[model samples]
Target: MMKFRHLRYFVAVAEELNFTHAAERLNMAQPPLSQQTKQMEDDLGTILIERGSRPMRLTRAGGAMLEHATRIW
Candidate 1:
């Protein structure tokens, strides 16, 4: 089951595309934010963001998930 915390983390990271900024927005550390995102991907069984890429882009699945998440929230 997916958690709301995971969704929140994903949304922050998705919007910022920078772990540091996202973490700051969440008032947490970058590592935890990254870990939460990893856990979310593991639960969903797919890659979300393309880490280490310039101007990070979401995977197709990530894009779809983001859209749904937005509506659900």
Candidate 2:
């Protein structure tokens, strides 16, 4: 069920490293953005953001995803 829009969502969050900021940048509500990102992780079967972290960070898989996503853009 992955889509190009999913990658766009991931890229925004990955770049901001914060869901709220990413949501703002995308001009969408935070909840949907979070849900979409969660769906992305679910679809990919890998953890992207380390939600437990204070400042938040991308997991190794997330880092790799970001790299490829940017190129695809």
Query: Who wins the lDDT comparison?
Result: 2
For residues 1-73, could you state the per-residue lDDT of candidate 1 as single tens digits?
7899888889888888888899999999999899889999999999999997988889999988888887777
- What lDDT does the true structure give each of the candidates? 0.89, 0.95
Model 2 CA RMSD to the hidden true structure, in angstroms: 0.5
Q: lDDT per residue, candidate 2, 1-73, as tens digits?
A: 8899999999999999999999999999999999999999999999999998979899999999999999997
For all predicted structures, in order, the TM-scores are 0.94, 0.97
Q: TM-score winner among the candidates?
A: 2
Error of 1 at 39 (Å): 0.6
Worst 10 residues of 1 by lDDT: 64-73
